[model samples]
Target: MSLPPADTAPAPEKGGDDLATLAKGGRTNTMGFVIRLVARIPFLVIATRLYGAEALGRFASALVLIEIVALICSLGEKRGLAQRLSEGAGENRSAEVNLVYDGMLLALGYSAIAALLLLAFPEPMFPNGTNSPYDLWLVATIPAFAVTEILLAAQAYRFDIATTVRTRAIVEPWTISIAAGLFFYLPGTRDAGLALAFITSIYAGLLTALWPFLRTYGLPRDWRPAPRAMLGMSASAFPLVGADAIERGTRLLDIFILGLFAPPQAVGIYYAAQQIASLPQKLKTSFEPILSPVITKNLRIGNMEAIAAQVRQVGFWIIAVQLGIALVLAIPGEAVMGLWGPDYVAGTATLAFLLAAEVVASMAVVSESVLVYIARKRNLAISVGIIALQAGLTVALIMAARNAGFGDGYQAAGAAGALMLALAASSLVKALLLKHLLGAPVSNWRWPLVYAAGAAVVVGYAFTFLPEWIELVVGIPAVLATYALVIWRRGFDEGDKVLFRKNVVPAPDASSPS
Candidate 1:
């Protein structure tokens, strides 16, 4: 399929229009996050209550390797594809489509090699040992997961985020939850329900993404695999791949290390907390697909100030929302974890720290979205350093907890604390570098955030005096409402309010339209 030619020329200023586009994407993804949160609770409950902590821990251990490998196999196309599509816009009708196909081919080749290697030497995947033979089949999902990433990236290049929402937010979570339930009931699949469910959901997401991708870009016309072009593409993608991998590594490395150093029960507790915390992380990452294309377009026009503005705007949105979520969940941390099961209630501190980690990491995430296009090597270096710091901190903290004669819960919290510190450091360093490069102040911090958080905490603390169920039911909404109202009134200006406004029509000129 041939893509329609895009205008590559430097067009007139449309800052509002760009923000509106971003706002639209944000609105869609925010809704997606809510849906995902709802769908995910059941899986967590089932995994914790039914499968038990040891089983869930083993599953998580395997997943860390599988997902990281799959992400690497994607060759950084999740964000890189947007730049490629932008740069190749006007070259030819088939140029853009063929570039996507090239990425798909390369990703497939990488996934195939990775899958086979893991299949032969399966020890790495199951550091704690496999749950069942079905766990080995997870190798097959690597290709599908990588391909889905590229496909979603292709759609995002066309400013289509609904497809991503459908695949990731709706289809994948629901499929996994339902499949996990069904597979658990079947005697033959009971031991491997989580693994099988995960595989099923990944393939379902792949199909969901593929449908829209084909409808949008179709099959590439006269597309032949070119060794030289693909090699160049791979070479160019190295920095992006490193940045992407390291950023993801920071999130998963703690779990991997825990699987090695701590008991499976400890890892399971940590994994549960991490999953709940990752909900807000989704808000930041979901913006990346839309943010990349916008940043790329502005970079093409040398709109450095515009890029800074977008980063600041989006960064604020992410941090604000993440902070609210962290407060809500963390304030009622024990109750939230207890819902999973009594065993998971021990992870309350871990849950709070992980949620805070997501909040602090918001700035770094938004900064990297621009840095990847502007200073790929520098960005990659920073990411590597950050992950290294996180690793060292995680091991040190976990050992310290153990030496102090603490239990597994304390050990998990130590890991979570390390992650929070590392992410805070990343946010500081990356935000500074982005400001230097853009020659403009790029900050998401606002005083109103402090006021809002304080207000929410006070309100939430009052609820903690009541029953746990009351804290969850009545307190959560109260905290969120107080924070939302305060932030809306104090933090959001007319421009910032654009994120919530559905259709922002510019005012007509007095001398013309009026």
Candidate 2:
């Protein structure tokens, strides 16, 4: 395929075109979320039911370190790559290609060192113990995962969100779910099923991303390793890297803390809740790929007002959808968790808090999309403070639960509550900072959201009166429908309705045109 010139690409000067682009991405990813949700349930069922809580807990613990390390090794290219490409690529398609490969090379190098260190000292990953000898091989996934991020980001720079939907939302989850099931039944692989499955999925997703990346960017021509230039790139990315790590850290830090204070079963239960809550989180994070490129383009043209408008538009979209999801899952949290097994039912409270956390974190996540460009140092500082605050609150709350002689479930709920609080604080602070920086109001809140949520809660509460199975089967849709109907009718203005509409092309008149 012949690549389009970077400079000739559509600039979102018109608000309608920008929103349409965002809505298109949102719709694709919303479908991807549904696909991911369906695919993820099977893995949760398999891991929690077959492997049991202790094994799942150990796997979850190890994954926290592995994923965080992988993200760090990627050097914030997930968002930074968009800015780099936007500023540097100009009309030179080859420059764009070379820029992406620069990040890829850096990520590969960092991942190699990180992987080797983890392979040498594996205790940080598996704090409890190894599930199997094959677990150690997970270190190899670091490079693949890191490289995949840069490739996907490069694709996103061209507004190719479908690639992300295909790789992250489809290939990754299905691969893991299927691989985990198959590995569980294989001889000598049961103990290592989850770890091995994760490794397999990361590489699978990498390949899936690499295909489109090659088609879009092709192979770099006349590109060579430049350590001095690469070093400069690394320095510039430091603030972004820290911001990304700390933002992600706020989510994982709770689990890291829980592993120390509570037993494996408790961590397992909490991990299950976290995974469920992460569905909505995925919705917001997926927006990042599309949102980053749009924001960077606007920033390039010094369109602060447009940037603020985009932030508010995307922020509301995220919060409204996330709130609906939170309500649907949290209202029937017990039943949702029960699908994993009876042991997971205790995570209902944790699930509710985690869901609420994701809903509240929407504004912060969207705000950071702009902040990373305009206020990198400030953003990094705020992210550090947010994680620090989260750490303190999580520890205090968990210790308080323990001293008060509460069960592990309560301890886990306390951690969840702390996360909710920390994220809420992050949202407030970040939104205000963005407003100050952009000199425009960036609030996503609307009174219709309150009305919509209240109406949905009434519908959901009524469903709770029914059997658990009915609550899950029929009630979930009922609540979502009610919320969507009310929000659409009362909340969405003409502009906001773009998310549901297709980009229609007018037909040529037979009399006037050939």
Candidate 3:
């Protein structure tokens, strides 16, 4: 018995392409985020230029629902799907290829059923009897959108993130904004542009998103998954979905629930603050695609030590970056919200809560990604219980605030903070449970907490001496860059520098450690 030839085997991935893969996707997403962040300014400028507050609030409310629905449809399968395809390739290469086809069909089938049901029963689709009939039209695109999601997951398994980033983070949002602008310019399209943009952008992005994956995997040409196989995969997937819903609901449920008591305008202001806080969140999430496949494959091979190590490494990396971003945003939350609209300034308290929650939430994120692959069912149970607890707390808090003679804005802000705090608590609990189950110190993010606080204080002090706009433009980057540079020089392990070599060779034309 001899070993397989080098050429016939999988090429060894230096630094495992973990950082490079994430970097590609992160850069794309961050660019898209920056685009969206920058574009939102113009997009809002355009929207206010055209739609006014009423239309804008309605649009925000509708989008808020669409996000909820999208999260539900995703069903925690993005990472799961990628893990399956990647590990399957390692175990049985040919079978993994077929898994790709079968997985896509299963996802599309599920999405189709959900979308059609909504399309047919447009009159009361949401569980809470929320969302509009127009939203049903948006739901109709889920089948195509989710199918593309499966394709992107497949690509992620292959350690190819460029395609996923382009389609998902860049093309989709960018196209939607463009379409909204073009469509709304027409007299007849004015009212329908938002929903139409939702539908069109989903399908539009799917087209480009699927292109690369299909080129590599081909059509579902030979994929035929068994009934039990699909169900088994879905079973593992369901808890993941539950955990994700819990995670996401903790974020969005407050807005929806609180909306009943407050004016749409108040909802609009809180939502603005919510988005401002969300900027830092994307930095944390950018690592999941790269982390999932690697973690899953290691777990499959009984590499518990590796699993624990990788989880901590990825966790620290993400939290450090997210902490820095959160600090910058926290310091200028008021100024940032003011740029959105003068009225949005009322959301300063809301911004503070959400930003604080994101920093807290980052701890839960790293642990959960590993937990989902390992003790997925147990992890999910914890997530479900906590979400149930949190949702109830959020409702009671809103009720109390409303009844206590608080103003609409104050009540709305209180509800938002309570909801965010619930999320922070759940995150801490989940991390602790994950630590017990995995025998890993997933809660070893204490150093980053120090870093986040230090970054905030340092940056806040620097910006206090400067004017507002200067703080935003120069001061913001200055604070973040200083922390990043400092941390890179001190905190990071040697393995982290391997990332720099992925894109550039020899560190320059020809170089050595000499």
lDDT of each: 0.90, 0.88, 0.65
- Report the lDDT tens digits of candidate 2 across residue range 15-99: 4566677888899889999989988888888889889999998888888898899999999999999889888889897888999
Model 2 residue 31 CA deviation (Å) reads 1.2
Q: Give the TM-score of candidate 2.
A: 0.96
Q: Candidate 2, after superposition: displacement of residue 478 in Å?
A: 1.2
Give stretches of model 3 more than 4 Å off: 1-41, 44-49, 86-94, 123-135, 225-228, 444-452, 458-467, 497-514
Per-residue error for 462 in candidate 1, Å, reads 0.5
Better of 1 and 3 by TM-score: 1
**What TM-scores do the predictions have?**
0.96, 0.96, 0.85
Judge candidate 1 at residue 471 and give its lDDT. 96
Which predicted model would earn the best lDDT?
A: 1
lDDT of 3 by residue, 278-386 (tens): 7667667766766777676656666565556556666666666667777777777667766766776677777888787787788788888887876778777777776
- Weakest ten-residue segment in model 2 by summed lDDT: 505-514
* Ordered list by lDDT, greatest first: 1, 2, 3
For residue 437, give model 1's deviation from the true position in Å: 0.6
